[model samples]
Target: MKKLFTLTILFFSLVAAAQTEDATSSEINENATFQRWAIDVGAGVHKPTRPFVDGYVSTPDLWQADLGVRYMFTRSFGVGLEFGYNNIQSDADASVTFESDYYRVGLEGIVNLGDFVNLKSASSRFGILGHGGIGVGFLTSNARTLTDATDHHLNFTAGIAPQYRVTKNIAVFTDLTIIGTTRNHYGWDGAVLGTEVRGFEGLMINASVGLTFYLGEGTDPADFAQDPIEAKVDAIAAQMEKMAIENADDDQDGVPNYLDRDNTTESGVRVDSKGRAIDMNKNGIPDDMESSLNARYASQSDVQTAINSANAANQNQIKQLINEGYVNVYFRFNSTKPTTYSLGAINTIVQYMKDHPSATATLTGFADEIGSPEYNKSLSERRAKMVSDVLAAAGIDASRLTQNGDGEDASVDKNSTDARQLVRRVTFKVN
Candidate 1:
């Protein structure tokens, strides 16, 4: 009995060492929450194969019960301690009839097979568990003639349990197990085993139905936890989706957000590779648009006649064009740089300031409703300052020029590109 106990201790020590190694090597989610403790109870039938006296054989009996507690180190592996009881009886027709009571206690290693095996059904409510262990067992005779006879042995147990989850905290399971014993002196019929038939020669099979109750505050049990690798894949997919959105070209201006200095460039408007409007001549209008505007105005004889005239009416007409915003300087979306063709409008202001030295002008800037009102207000101020700088550089006195930002002009349909373009401008008021 001492030797058997020593061997059992050594076996359990080895199992603990192996379990520690497996736990350290496995990948686990440190942040995930799950139930790790459970209680198992079962009732079963057992069949024992044993050494019986002549004409004496025991029949299979449905008198076995088991109770156990388990703790999972991870989703896939765990350990358990269990106690079991079994009753064996001889057939009534046997020449020599006997009865025995068997009891055992074991410490076992458990594996969640559904988690270890890469099955498609692993995510389903059905699962499988495999367990094995070394333990001690005692068998005592129930006959009056052999009241002092008992069999003491070391036991080895192995089993598989197929289970179905009925709820988050409960599951139903069926187990099939084989128990093997060694170094038993007495047989089931209360007879001593022959000296030659000494080592490990006892076997019993058990089939049981049971329930497992999980105990923890978490809603997910360790058996049903998500795979760490699958969770990482999901995280990576979400990051890729965010990257796709950040890199998208919202304005369809042929440039991604990171590289686009001007995000709201008008469609069909010629732009450089960087997505800024192209103004090769350094004028207030884009080169592609300057030609068309020049052609349209060149055929207008009345407009030309007014510009060449020096009379009060022609001067008033030009001033009215500037003040009324017809001759205003246009800008690209979200830019302080005036369009190349609109440079002529600044020259018109400069000429008027020169002709009437006593006159002053106020340059009020306006922006399209593309951005926040506060941001557009600041942008409008910068646009007015830019136009004021141009006039100062063109010899208009700083004292005679007043710059103001009217902020966003929301009168037009904000969804219309043409209307938005028509509003990003700086108009003059001659004082």
Candidate 2:
């Protein structure tokens, strides 16, 4: 029993490792919510229907406890191993009193019926699972009229666990199962002459309450939620949260760096409408320009710092126009299809154009230098027109938006992935 328990632990540890490694698959486009693993530990009562004979009477209620670990390969099917202890009290019909204590271990296939049915609501708090398996059963017992020895036999177990999900990390569960072990021939010699001898010796029913802990990096409730609505809401919420982070103003300035004309302004400092730091002492000159002029007059070494600051402000202004006043559309290699991830970018552009009815945008598309010049040029042109059509469909006037393709001539890098990524994008400038 000890060896089996150790083996069981080792087996589950391997499965847990595999589960973590295989949880996220690159081939699948769906989210990682389907990958899940859990450990269940529960204790319950065990009732021996009969020890060795068909007509054996019931004894004082027996008891049992179990610990199990499972890995769900999918939403509905999973496999697990369980190990536990069971104590059977002595009892008799008209012939003998039979008592035994057994160590149980089993490998079970689990089926989650809730996945197939709409039994759970979007926020349902409970779930149900069914499992069954076969393993070795080690029994140590002494029968008054039959035998007194330790025996091991093949055992089969089937159970249903109804679980109440208390939170993302914890759940309460009750398992109701029937376990049957191989017949004990040594203790059955003359126990009951007239008792029918079935192939199996003991039939025990066990009911236990335990806790299940979900594991891995994806531990949120939404990661395992089965309801379509709940899953969709969770997915959308995640995307929105990500976008908020991507567009957050780390410096707490009113304008985010993605849309800030000047991102270097210190916190609590006053700024111009354009987001540049105010020149309190200089006559209406921006602080950055005054600093740059002063540095140039003092020394060339300080001039580089001033130039860098000016360049940073200029880059911020460009980003403010591109990310806030306009929008960018990204494309895949050799295709004009806009990426789904860029939908938020398109929406931002549309909203900006709507707010400023007189605003016009010039869309320019470029391509990496991967293919022939002719092919790259055409791909970029198609990509630019696709963006124009998308904007027109979204109520932007076609006359206000003009598009052009720069093709490989605008490639940031021919070999570097980081640089070429920008080459495959379509950007717009407010006109």
Candidate 3:
């Protein structure tokens, strides 16, 4: 009895140690909630082997019962305290007849084979566990002739259980276990095994079916806990998929499909970041050219006076507007094509060149400070070339148009989208 009490203390101590070790590990996800405690109960048949009276083998009987409480430190590893009872009797046809009652208390280290092998990916409701432990057992004779004779021994037990989850809190399981004992003072039929019989004097095999009841705050049990690494990988995969959807450009415009209002803009047509064609005015011409024409001829009387004065002052004014960045052609983010609102600026430059047949124009392109210096430099060159192409298409001689890339404009705050849009432009220098 004293040994039994001591073993009980050792059992709880080992359980505590296992839990402490698991708590300190970095792999454990502290925020994950699941049931970590469970109660196990079972009953079945037991057969005792060896160390029995000659011709007195134990009979098979439904006389074995066990109960245990388990704590899972992780999904894969745990510890349990179990108590078992068995009623052993010799076969009626045997040479000798006897009946004995057996009892044991053990501490088991449990490994969840299903979780250890990542079987959850294949099946969530099926699982298996392997367990082994050592404990103390007491065997006492129930035979009338040797009622006072008893056996005290140290026992070892190992078992495998296959379980099926029936609900969130309950599961059904079947277990097969072998128990071996040493230091037996008495045999199965009440015969005394003297001190000479020392090592592994007795053995018993048991098969049982039982139910496990999970206890905790959440519906998920620790047995079905997800692997932390697997969970992280799933989260990253979801984020990447979302980014792919958000960045898709079905119209091949500079704008992403998610923000594009017009997904089927014709090729080479100028558009805004929202993928809308940039024709702010109802007039057939783009708004940029309309605005330049409106600014150039705001006063009809002054224009007529300049025309009567040989149009020199009027040409100088137009030249000043083009050179001072007032009539600049603006583009959308990362696009070489001028915006629909800025198309009028190209027409203004074209008109100025046609009016002064001997004049030549320089188109210097610039980008916002968003990308690498080298990429921005390339983008700016493309913007200048695109504007020069439009000018050549409009009957302006290509030889009269010189394109230059000024790279990124660092004057404005890079974080401001409106300010950055103002700088992604092509400016004119008409001679």
- C-alpha lDDT of all candidate models, in order: 0.76, 0.64, 0.77
Off by over 4 Å in 1: 1-33, 54-59, 120-122, 144-149, 191-197, 217-219, 239-431
RMSD of each: 11.6, 20.0, 13.3
Colliding pairs, model 2: 44-208
Per-residue lDDT over 1-431 for candidate 1, one digit per residue giving the tens place of the 0 to 100 score: 34443544554564476567556755654224668898999998888876555425556676899999988776677789999999777778877777778889988877777876854244557788878788898888776244345567788787899888899889999999888788777676666666524555777889999999998756577777666667578789999998888788877878877778878767766787787878776654555555544543331234335555634555777777667665677888889998765766777788889998999999999999989999999999999999999999999899999999999999778987666777888988996
Error of 2 at 124 (Å): 3.5
TM-score per model over all chains: 0.53, 0.44, 0.57
Clashes (N, CA, C under 3 Å) per candidate: 8, 1, 3
Query: Residue 168 lDDT in model 3?
Result: 85
Q: After superposition, how far is residue 211 of candidate 3 from its true place, in Å?
A: 1.7
Q: Please report how far candidate 2 places residue 410 from its true position, in Å.
A: 62
For candidate 1, the clash count comes to 8
Quick one: RMSD of model 3?
13.3
- lDDT per residue for candidate 3 within 1-431, as digits (tens), equals 23433444554465567577677765646335568898999999978877776536546676899999988876667888999999888777877677788889988877778976788898889889877788898888777344345577788777899988899899999999888787777776667755536776678889999999999765578777666677689889999999899889876767888898977554345788888767765534344434444543332234334334535645687777667776677777778877765766777788889989999999999999988999999999999999999999999999999999999999877775545666888888988
Task: State in Å the error of residue 57, model 2.
Answer: 4.6
What ranking emerges by lDDT with the best candidate at the front? 3, 1, 2
Cα lDDT of model 2 by residue, 12-128, tens digit: 454455445346643442236544678888886766665544335354364778988887765556688889897665554445456656787888767665655654654467788
